[model samples]
Target: MSAAPHTPAPKNLGRTALICAGVAMGMTGLSFAAVPLYDMFCKATGFGGTPMTGTAGAGKVLDRTMAVRFDANVAPGLGWTFTPESPDISLRVGETKTVFYKITNKSSRASTGIASYNIAPEKGAAYFVKIQCFCFTEHTLQPGESLEAPVVFYIDPEIAGNRELDGMKAITLSYTYFASKAGQPLAQGGTAPAKGDAATSNL
Candidate 1:
C-alpha cells in the first residue's frame, strides 16, 4: 500500500493534548488573578487615573505649600450623611497629614457603605499618595450612627516638579460613599448618632 498512510504515533497525539490542557489551565489561572493584578498595577502606577499608594513619605517635606481641598458625598441609595470635616488644608508638598470625614446613617435600619475616592485635576492623582485611608475598607453604621473616617496621606514632592501641574496650587480630594450589603456589622450597645457635629477633626 502507501506506507500504511504514514500514521502518526499515539504518544505524539497524547503529548499535544497534554500541552493544550496545560496552556488552558494557565490561562484560567491568569483570568482568576487578573483583577487583583490590575488593582495593584493601578495603585502602583496610578494608571487610568487611579490614585497611587505609598507609606510615610521620605521626610523631605518641601517648603512650598499646596492647598488640599476635601469633599465628601453619599450616593443616593446610601441613606448616609457624609461631609468633610475640613473644607480645605494647606500643607507643604511631601508633608504627611490626616483628614477626617463624618458619615452618619440617616436610615432607621442598619446600613453599610464603601467609599470611592478621587483627586481632581486628575493629573495630581499620581502624586497624591495615600498612606492609609478609610476608603480602603468598608464601614457599617447602626441606625442613626456616625463615624469619623480618617485618611493619612502626603502629596509627592515630585508633584512640585511637574511642569504640567505648574500653577496648580490646589488639589481636591473627593470621596463618595455608596450603599453596600457587604460591610462590617454595625456596632451594638452604642448611642444613636444625632445631626449635631456630624464630623470631628482630630487632625
Candidate 2:
C-alpha cells in the first residue's frame, strides 16, 4: 500500500513564517545596537585592546616603571604627515606624563582628519588611562600648517595588580588618522569616516 498519503506539509507554515519574521526583526535591532553595545563593552571590559577613558587620579607614582611607545599614521590620500614627537618613554605607573604628536598638512589645500587609537597586550588596555587625548576630535589644518597635539596619560597602578597583565614589561600605544567625513556628501545612512588601519608600535 502507498505510504499513508505523504505527510501533509506543515499545517502551521504561516506561524513558522511569523516566527522567522520576528527573528529577522530581532537581528536587525541587534545590528543597530551593536556599535554602542561594543563601545560600552570596551569601556567597561577593555576588550580588543580598547583603552579606558578617564581623568587624572591620585597622581601617585610607583617605584616600578614601564616603557611606553607612541605610534602614528595617516590615511591614504589624507595629505598629512603624522608622527609622534617622542618615539618612546619610560615612566612609573600612576605618574601622569604628556606627549605630543605632530601633524602637518602637506597638501596645498586645507585638510581635516580625526584620530583613533588603541593599546597592545589588549589585557593592559584596561589600565592604560588617558587623562587627555586628541582622539575623536577633528583636526583641521590650513594648507601647510603644522601643529603638535598633546596626549597626557598615566598607567593605573591597579594594572600592577592585574594577574592577566602581570609579567608585562611594556605596552604600545598605536594611533591612526582617518580623513574627516564630517561634512562630506554621502549616500543614505552613511556614517563619518573616523576609522583607519592600525599601525602597530613597540614599547
Candidate 3:
C-alpha cells in the first residue's frame, strides 16, 4: 500500500563490502605485527624498563657513581635457587663491571631454565646498558648442580647529564628464572659433581 522501498545500487553495495573486507585484512595484519614491532621499539628506546644492549663499553667514565642492587627470583616448578654473588655494587657511570649469579638445581632430576631481567626506576632504563648477559639463554643443571653466570654492563655516561636523574642514587637490577623449552642451547653443561669433586667456578 506504500511506495516501493528504494534499493541501494549494486555498485555501491559492492563497494561498501570491499571496504569492510579491506579493513578486516588490515586489522589482522596489524595484530600479527604488534608484538615484534613493540619489542623493537622498546629495545631501541628502552621504553617500559627495557635496558639497551651495548656491544662494547662506553669508553668514557664519569666521576659520578651509582649503586646497583641485585634481586633474583625463581619461578615455581623450576626447582632452582638463584642468588647474586653480592647484594649490590657501586660503580662510576660508563665504567664496565661484571657481576655473577649463582643458580643451583635442587630437584632430583635434570632441569633447564632461562632468565629474564629488567631495570627498576624505569626512568633510568634508557641509560642502562648491558654488554653481556646470561639472560634469555637456557642453562641445564643436574641434581644438586650449580652454575655461576655473569652479567657485564655499564651505565651510560649520558645519564650524568640528564637533570631528571641527578638526584637518583641507585638502580635495582632484577632477574627471574623460568622453565623454558626453547632458547639458545645451554651455555655450559655438566653432571652433578661427586661430593668431593673439585669445583671449576668461583663466586
Candidate 4:
C-alpha cells in the first residue's frame, strides 16, 4: 500500500495558530480597557472620590482665610445621640484643628453604622474643607454605650481670598448613621431631613 499519505499536520497547525492569535488579541484588548472600566466602576460605587485627609493644608491656598464650620448629625435608627463638644464654628486657615462630638447609644439594642457628609455650595467640596470623620469606618456600639469622636479638619487658605466665597460664614459637615447590615455600611447621600429624623441630628 502506498505509504499512508502523510497526515496534513500543517493544515491542522495553521488552524490552531489562528485560534491562538485571536485569543491573544482579545486578551490584549481586555487589558487596555480594564483601567477605564475600573474607574467607571469606582465612580458609580463612590469608591474613588478624593479621600478625606484630616490634616491642615492638605489642599491649601495661599494668602486667604476661610471660615470653617463643624456640623454633626445622626439618623433615626442609629439608637444613638450626638452633640458637638466644641463651638460649632471656628476660623482657621492653613491649619487643622480637631473638633469633638459625643455619641451615645440610647437604645438597648447594639447599633453599628457609618457616617457621610459633603460641604456646601457644591463647588467648595473640592478645596474649602477637609474632614477627619469617623463614618469613614463603621462604628459598633454596645447597648447604651457612649463615646466621643473627633474630626480634625481645616480650610484651604484660598477660600478667604476668593470673592465668590468671601461672605460664606459656615460650612456644615453633617453625618447620618445607617444600619450596618450584611457587613455593609449604610450610605448618606439622600436629602437631609428638614427636621432631625429620629435617627439623625444636625448638631
Candidate 5:
C-alpha cells in the first residue's frame, strides 16, 4: 500500500541545458550581427542619418566648413540629379543658420526615398544641428521634378567656454545622401570650412 512503490520523476537536465545553450547562441549571433544589420538599415532608410562626431573639445569655438556629401542610386531606366544648394555653410558659436539643398529627377520614371545627414569638423560635434531632414521617410519625385531641402542648425553656446575650443572660429556641417533602387535620395558630398571665418556672438 506504499503507493505501488514511489517513483521519482525523470529530469531532462540535458534537454534543458541544450535549450538554454541554443537560446544563448542565438542571442549571441543576433548581437554579433546587430551592427551590420543596423548599418544596412541605416543605409537603406537613412534612419537617424549618421552623425559626424568631432574631436574638438566642448565649449570650443569652431570656424570651419565641413564638406557635405550625398550618395544616390537611380534605377536603370531613371535619370536623377541631386545637389545641395548650400553645401558649404559657416556657423559661429551660438548662431543658427539654415541651408538649402535641391534635388531633381529628369527621368520619366518616378523616384522615392529618404535623405538623412550628419555634421563634421571633428571638433564641432557638440553644436546643436537640426535638419528639416527627409531621411527615414519616402519621397517621390516625378519626371523633371525638382525639390529644395533645407537644414537648420546652430552652434551650442558652450563651445565658446571650452578651453580647447578657444580661438576656434568656425565648423562645417556636412551631409551624405543615399538613394533607393527606385532612385533613393542621397546627399552629394562633405562640407569644408571656409578659410578666415570669424566667430560670432553666442545665441
Candidate 6:
C-alpha cells in the first residue's frame, strides 16, 4: 500500500503565517524610512545636490573666484511665483555670501509651500556649504502676499585642492517651491490638498 500524504501540522502553518506577516511589516517600515534616511545621508556627505550644513562660515577664504547662478521654481498647483533676487554672483572659494529669493502667492486662497534646494554639477556639491538657508521649511501666505527668504553659503576652500573641479568655473543653486500640508511636501508625497494654511514648520 502507498504511504499517506504528509500535511503540515496546524502549529507549523500558523508559525509560517506569522513569519510572513512579520516580513511584510518590516518591508513596509523600510519603505517609510527610505526617504528620510537618504536625505540624512545626502546632507552628511553632500552625495547629491544637497549641500553640507554649517554653523558658521569657513574660517579661511581663498582668492580664486567662482560664479554661482541662482535658480527658482514653483510647482504647478502651488499657486505661487518664486524667483531669485539676483541671477548670479561671484564668490571666493571660501567666502560666505547671503542671497535672497522672492516668493509671492498668486492664488485667491491662502496656501502653504516648502522650499527644496539642490546644486548642479554633482561633483562640486561636496565642496559647497550653507551657513543658513530657508529650505525644508513651510511658509504660508495670504492671497497676493509676498516674502523674501535668504540663503547664506560659501564654497569650501578645500575645493582649491580638488583637481577634478579645477575646470569648473560656475555652480548653480536651485530651489523649487512645492505645495505643503502638515509639514509634508504635497508635490512629492502627501494626500493633502494644495489649498490650506499651515503654521511654520521645519525639517
The TM-scores of all predictions, comma-separated, are: 0.79, 0.78, 0.80, 0.59, 0.54, 0.83
Model 5 scores worst on lDDT over the 10 consecutive residues at: 194-203
**Candidate numbers, best lDDT first, in rank order:** 6, 3, 2, 1, 4, 5
- Model 3 off-target regions past 4 Å? 1-9, 181-203
Highest-scoring model, lDDT:
6
Task: Write the residue-wise lDDT of candidate 3 on 124-160 in tens digits.
Answer: 8798898899977889899999999999999999997
Query: Positional deviation of 2 in candidate 1, in angstroms?
Result: 12
Q: List where candidate 4 sits over 4 angstroms from the true fold.
A: 1-66, 129-131, 187-203
Model 2 alpha-carbon drift over 4 Å, by segment: 1-23, 183-197
Poorest stretch of ten by lDDT in candidate 3 = 193-202
Worst 10 residues of 4 by lDDT: 194-203
How much is 200 displaced in model 1, in angstroms?
Answer: 24
Per residue, candidate 4 scores C-alpha lDDT tens digits across 147-193 of 88877776666555568866666555555556666544443453433
Question: 1 or 5, which is superior by TM-score?
Answer: 1
So what's the TM-score on candidate 2?
0.78
Q: Is candidate 2 or candidate 6 better by lDDT?
A: 6
TM-score, candidate number 3: 0.80
Judge candidate 6 at residue 79 and give its lDDT. Answer: 92
TM-score of 6: 0.83
Instruction: Please give the distance, in angstroms, between residue 79's alpha carbon in candidate 2 and its true position after superposition.
Output: 1.2
State, as a TM-score between 0 and 1, how close model 4 is to the true structure. Answer: 0.59
Flag regions of model 1 displaced more than 4 Å: 1-11, 183-203
Model 4 residue 179 CA deviation (Å) reads 1.6
Backbone clash pairs for candidate 3 read none
